[model samples]
Target: MSTTVVEVENLSFRYDKRLKENILSNISMTVDQGEWLAVIGPNGSGKSTLAQLLVGLIEADSGKIRIKNTVMDDTSKWKVRRHIGIVFQNPENQFIGTTVQDDVAFSLENLNMPYDEMKFRVDQALDLVGMSSLRHHDPSQLSGGQKQRVAIAGILALKPSILVLDEALVMLDPKSRRELLTVLQNLKRKENISILSITHDMNEAALADRIILLESGKVKNCGTSEQLFVAEPDLEPPFPELLRRELLKRNRNIPNEYMTEEEMVNWLCKSRLTV
Candidate 1:
């Protein structure tokens, strides 16, 4: 049975009260435990605002948010925040420690965790993100992807059940993005961390188990990548799906279904052999 880790009900927010338009209006979503849910939309669609609201960085103007059984409000927001960890767009902006190890340990240290337990968590989190070897290296000296990994390790040390990423992979190159995604996939499988990734990148969103499409401060659709594309045909599809469409245009005998990169490669190889 799946558990609901996070739930937002009729949530509405606005930066300014006089604007008369809510930045997010009647937004309701739930993230199940161990599920990877991606929120994708164009700029100014309130995606980032929703991310901030989820972590209690900003209060919603109306409605409620629940992290597990705890309801989010001014009084309980801090307590609710303990179960959620947020990673922002720029890894550099999030760095606070001189070394990767220090960065990962920063959060645990803030909780006044014991030195021994903190050290164990630091080591474990670093290993989870594949940054154990770079523990001694300065975060400034690391690559963009490495720094992001360190950021994630910092969160992992806190052992948050829900992870919120706000355009966290936007700064990475293609190879770096893929590597980071692979790391996240492993974390999802091994640790069963529930991920809520807010991104504009369709390719990244397509990898998620389910996608939430936000438009003009409201959810336009919520479904798997394939279902969302089928519902909103004008939206850009992932690279593999796009390739499949092009092949179909050429009258190639290929299944018109969404595929991951690996699946696409295997299909091409099989087709070539059969031909």
Candidate 2:
């Protein structure tokens, strides 16, 4: 049986007391262990607000949030926090330490972790994100993706079961973004960690196991990439899928599952060899 790492039930929130409208209303979702779940929507769709609510950054007006089956309340909020980690949109904003190593060690230090144990975890986390080589480098000297990975490494050191990324890749270049995604993919497979990424990046969302589409503070659609992108003709697919469709229109036979340019190229190469 699969275990649910994070569960939100009938979640709703509102920032202003005077306002009649809620930022998020009647939202419900679950993130299973090791699953990659992407929440996508336009600006002001309550995606960021929902992320904040899940991480206990702000109190929800109505709803329940559970981490690892334990209901989140004031009593268990700290414990619930231990099971989850979050990375924000701005990597520089999350950084406090001057060097890569020090930044990764900051979280463990706050928990009053023993020096030896902290050293071990910091080293382990840096290596996991492929930032060990730049352990001594200043964060200002690192690229945007490298800085984001450092932020993730800080969260990774805590060994949380769930990671919530609130548009963490929005600041990176395309190459760096792809590299970061590869690192995330490896982490998901190797550590079996549940990932909840809230973003407007359709390319990133399409790569996830499931996607939740939010509009006007409500769940507009919820389904897998194929179900949403391939099955729905009215909605536009991601760039890769659009290219794949254009190729198919020209009588080029590409596998239905080959949604990316790289996947299509590899399939074609293998087919040529077999012929």
Candidate 3:
């Protein structure tokens, strides 16, 4: 008896004019509580579209969506949206407030939360993303990575159970990207929030509990990253060659299932025989 948080069944959708060409078809998947699921695909493969669907930004043409036993519909869209927070690929698109704090406070206002609680949540969210120092800075004045952090703070303030990140780490450099990854990992550990990330970064996808591959409006593959890396040699380019040695080296299973660099380092250190 798993706690299924998100349930999508036979979903189909397309633009008003492109009704003939569906952007997503028969897309069905389940994301359980505290599980991180990565949705990966090439450009224009409806990955972004699916993210929009999860948050009710775009309606599904057919089928159903159930969140915590409640069905998704136009009437419940606004209320249902509160349970899911989305961070877009481009941070610029997400900013609506002039200042960082104000931007993060925007969602709280719409949520109609109490002022005192809102203030605390806003402050805490900023702290969570390491943006508390920039709370007074203008959002436009920040760099790309900083803006993305502000965007994340906005969602964090909302305190949604589900976080949908559509290439949220794409803009940041290696350091900032890694830092944000740590922030997300901490949030997951502390809050037990479910994360659904739509990205092309195979390395990032590797970290998720489940990987779903989308291609031209359909699910191409879905499984643990290790399963795909070990079984199918004909996978898409940039396969998991990094884990090949640990996976295929005599033993059938890899020594560790974690996808983090620190975890891998620890595994290597512990594997050595220090005499």
Candidate 4:
């Protein structure tokens, strides 16, 4: 059975206590161990707020957030945060060290971890993120994607069980974004790290194991990419899914389900061969 790593029930939060309307209303969700759950919505949908709440950066007005079966509270919030590693939208803002290797070791050093253990973790993290080659490189000189990888490596060195990405890929170019997503997918496969990615991009959401559609602070839908797209046809889908819909419109006999870019390419190749 899959372990439930994170759980939220009837969660509600607002910046202003005086305000009657809550930013997040009765929000509920669960992220299983090693599962990537993407919470997607437009700006002001409270996605970032939810991410903050999950990591205990901000306290919720009501409801409960449980991390690995432990409920979040003032006393336990610090411990809860230890289980989660968060990467924000701006990688540059997260960078502190001049070199990639130093950045990855910063957190471990702060924790007063033994020198041998910290070095082992830093090296392992860089290797996991494929940033070992750039470990000696200056962080400021690296590409946007590479900087993000370093940021991720810094978090990985701490060995957190869950990773929360708050629009982490929004600033990246298309190729950079794709590359980062590939890195994340590999991490999920190899490290069994549960991921909660709050994003507005359908392309990013489609790649997740499951998606939660948040709208006006409420969860509008929750399901696989195909199920969500089928249920909400008006919503924009990933580029491949959009193309699939367009083909179906022309009476093409393609399967009516969501397909990733590679899957779509393979299907097209098979169709041409059969024809």
- Residue pairs with colliding backbones in model 4 are none
Off by over 4 Å in 3: 16-19, 236-240, 243-275
RMSD to native, candidate 2: 2.5
| RMSD in Å for model 3 | 3.7
Whole-model Cα lDDT of every candidate shown, in order: 0.92, 0.88, 0.82, 0.92
- The digit string of per-residue lDDT tens for model 3 on 1-275 reads 65898999999889875568889999999999888999987788899999988888888999899876678899988778778889998888888998999999998898798999999999999998889998999999898778888998898888888999988898778888767778888888888889999987777777788898888999988898867554555554233356535455656444544334556556556666231
Give per-residue CA lDDT, model 1, range 173-259, as digits (tens): 999999999999999999999999999888989989999999999999999988998789889999988888888888889887777
lDDT of 2: 0.88
Superior candidate under lDDT, 1 versus 2: 1
Tens digit of lDDT per residue, candidate 2, span 60-171?
8888998998988777888888889899999888898989999999989999999999999999999999999999999978999999999999999999999999999998
Q: Estimate each model's TM-score.
A: 0.97, 0.92, 0.86, 0.96
Instruction: Report how far residue 23 has shifted in candidate 1, in Å.
Output: 0.8
Q: Candidate 1's error at 205, in angstroms?
A: 0.5
**TM-score, model 2 to reference:** 0.92
Ranking by TM-score: 1, 4, 2, 3
